[model samples]
Target: MSINVFLFSKSFAQQHTFEVKNGSFVYDGKPIQIHSGEMHYSRVPHEYWRQRLKMIKAMGMNTVTTYVFWNFQETAPGVWNFSGDRDIAKFIKTAQDVGLFVILRPGPYVCAEWEFGGYPWWLQKVPGMHVRTLNQPFLDSCKTYIQHLAAQIKNLQITHGGPIIMVQAENEFGSYVAQRKDIPLEQHKKYALAIKNELVHNGFDVPFFTADATYLFKGGSVEGALPCGNGEDNVDTLKKRVNEFHNGEGPYMVSEFYPGWLDHWGEKFVKVGAKGVVNQTEKYLKNGVSFSYYMIFGGTNFGFTSGANDGDSPIQPDLTSYDYDAPISEAGWATPKFDSLRSLMKKYVTYQIPDVPDAVLVIAINEIKLNKTVDLFNGIVKNIQPVVSDTPKTFEDLNQGFGYVLYRKKFDNAINGTLDLKGLRDYALVYVNGKKVGELNRQVKKFTINIDIPANATLDILVENMGRINYGPNIEKNLKGIISPVMINGKIITGNWNMYKLPFDQVPDLSKQKSSYVAGNPVIYQGAFKLKKVGDTFLDMSNWGKGIVFINGHNLGRYWKVGPQQTLYLPGCWLKKGKNTIQIFEQQNDVKNETISSVTKPVLDKLNLPKE
Candidate 1:
């Protein structure tokens, strides 16, 4: 059958009448009920998207909702990528294929525990920019993104053949506006209205909605729209909130019913039990309310996509693993929550829910040992590079992300009092002659330290890009790398910085030299292993420092001295049976060069290394 016909047939088969009455949702022109679950395409791999969809369907859910992240699509402004896991078109199509309706939340601002709340970093660079306001540049960009997204899925609408029945505007605008305390209410409402009109003009034909806290919706300031409350766990409270604002007959949906919690660096992993979810779901369903679990399948925040939250204390950016302890695990495995929710759902729906898909096999490979060691710095100084100026530079000027940057300056005078960093925004590791000395961190704000600089000795100061400040009021001015001037004693040292951008993508050329000497910023450490018979094996990187590992030139993510993630899962597809080349770029020069072995278990140990 043709794609359109197939989509039409599938959508028609799962079609159920839904309407708004007096303000409540009506089914077949009558007040009908809903039970939904949430998931994101960017989190789940394309190959496993279908499996997760089936699992959600089995959980007795009639609808599946997802947030269409703008930054994920427009990785860089104007450039769009919709294939693979990012294919929202295919994701919606697959939802229809598996007998589930979809609700698309195309947020130019999706604060879904995502990096920058799904707003692209490029947007921050706009001149005279004030995000989420009536700023012309910001609004214009939002309009373009909405229009581009609409063009991709407009034809596939439920009114056409797709399962996307509703589209949400800005998420929790009232909370941010009110929380900003400094900003006036009138200014906040003006920004909200501008976003609503932008959506309308961008060909968003479906019903428009906004999710807010219970108290915010009751204020009666928002224009004509459907009201939905987030985090309303109590059935009575949710029903009361709906009745108060949405009228007695409106479709009451829990837009963001929190199913699982998130985690940050240096914290214990958080998890919620299956019983609690089932009980809450049952309560909501029995009370005649429709709900959507915020994240039924919380996927990985791969790369630098993780964001942060602000509450009582100041928290930095989020960890890479978004494993929200939801119904579906980050690796796409079905959990006890899935089974409990599924059993409860079967009691309410009449569809034939299929069995859960098989889980991916994660086997532990054997551990190997490193029998060789190499000294990184064993050369005398010759032809010393001169310093140009004594001015300090921020990370923006250097164009670097996470990791470390070194600042070196040569001086003829010997100073021993105290080395002062004019503006040390974050963390720094002090090293003399490639030897460990001491460290300074921003948490304590100690940027000055006493250091003895030997005469004719080249001074080296290494600074680590701990992490970007992801959320809250202080995020606007977050600049990573070395954010300022370097000084020795009380005098400013002038010279070339020889700035190094320690991004993981930088692969060094290891073919130029013998076992003699290599002087460069990113020194490539290479070792060859002759696999007797390689089928599939995990490379144990516990012996080495934090850095990306490449086997035959295949990127394994960033491995640090942090706990829970020491060994990277190397697929058998990337490994060959014989002689394999392994390369590692250590961000810190202090890392001991050790041989890596194959491990059958995941390494989860904390090391006494400097935190980045």
Candidate 2:
């Protein structure tokens, strides 16, 4: 490879020009194929970023592709966080240091099975805001996100001696536009152009590409940008489709070659075997078709960052563990899939692949007894002030985005009738007079339960915003909590009600709260386990019910009795060599023994198979 030296800042830098010409990626005037793997910085801990990048390179990947989650960086309107795990610039820089080029996909709307499809939940509050379109309010916000994001990485572009080569426009937009019968093709193209223009306006000076299925190229691709196919491994089909839509053929790339699949709660874990991945990858390598494994190393969702999918099936919320069953496990350990792919890459790539890094140590600890408990109905959490209203309000109405919300109403007169929960976005645990009643789940399509209400009875309905719809048209209407009205029998229960916003932004200090376990109510259980040495481990949640877990104050994400994902990936880096604390906000399931064990391996495939 020829070196291009240029004077950068106060020092001479090795700046190389990257371009797509004559069907190939030409770096410094030499044609080369991109061997890329996708991994998101927002998904993995920042402490393990460098090691993960190194693993990607070791697997014979020369390029690292990532989606810059708009929601991850900007949690609220005008609020941006690029430091720590939200640091995309550092991630790209680290990839370059590990001898890998970068393909940046900064989606103001990236449906990576991420929360709200990588969109800030607050966007729903903007009047007349329609996402993935030319809606002015939405576009205005997109521009702001782009400007702030560009400020962090514009200097890191390949032209500026950085690793970023190609920047992706709106992700899989064709899928969204193709289904809309009311919208014209021309209007869709204009919408795409607007996003592409925003990228250019913010100084993202690089070759831009739009990724979609073959049929979506026309609707998803911008005029000046390259159109890349996703989830298509057949080289001939890929070429034909590109030529048919793009009017020019040659350099073909599969933006998302899935080695594994995403998992949703209450469903069987999706697994793409290593043999299948190897076969498809070998074909791509032999045909000189560039590709990026959708997830080379699927990490933990680590909080309420997981999204949901609602296609032909019922609304399926994604599990907290984004293990993806890929080459690397969620705990950052190598697997047979990784080994097989590494060997295959060594056979095809002319360049020398680096040696695989040493696997991170994983330790298993004995059962940790949860001795202290705090009731949610009590005063464990003192931050959330109740919003009093006549009717139940949604999470958005209360200025809250994620987490659970409690709706309480006291009836003065006794009534025997069916209690109907109207417009419950996701899941809810029903309680009357501080006693557990029946439950309502949006996933199971349960909306009403028969209840015998006594005089002076307090009805408490705690609803959880499982996750927003990350895909399809329904995302526009995703509002958590009771969106409409609660009814008894045939009449609306209209009166005074208190709605508490429990966003759980951080695990509250519950040490001062009473330490007694309350049955059938949402409670915070606390425990401690001492370790001589620290390493990666999985916390088994089979003994407990649905809730989020926090270790040493770091939110490890949600876990439910709903099988498929029974263990949560606990990183060793987050633990110390002494007493470590664990707190679980379990909402249901009366605990016989408040105990959980740290296991070495994850039990992700075990599904709660339905009975006839």
Q: Count backbone clashes in candidate 1.
A: 25
How well does each candidate superpose onto the true structure, as a TM-score?
Answer: 0.82, 0.96
lDDT of 1 by residue, 1-612 (tens): 001112234435665443456555654455556567888888755766777787777666667889888988986668998887688899988888887778888877877877667777656566887777667888889888888888888866766646777778777776676667677778778777777777778666667677877777743125656778788787666667766765454567788887787765444556678888888888877776788887887766654555666434344434455657788766666778877888887676555666777765554434333332222333111222323334656655654444455666654666677877747655566666555566665544467888887776656666665444444555465565555556666666666555444444444444533333332222446777766554434557666554556677765545555434455555454566677677765544444554567665444333343465
* Clash totals for all candidate models: 25, 1
| Number of clashing residue pairs, candidate 2 | 1
Best by TM-score: 2
Runs with alpha carbons beyond 4 Å of true place in candidate 2: 1-12, 381-384, 609-612
Candidate 1's C-alpha runs over 4 A off are 1-22, 26-32, 218-222, 247-249, 310-314, 368-390, 399-404, 416-428, 440-450, 456-470, 484-496, 506-545, 549-556, 564-585, 588-612
**Colliding pairs, model 2:** 23-251
Taking every candidate in turn, the Cα RMSD to the unseen true structure, in Å, is 5.2, 2.5
**Highest lDDT model number:** 2
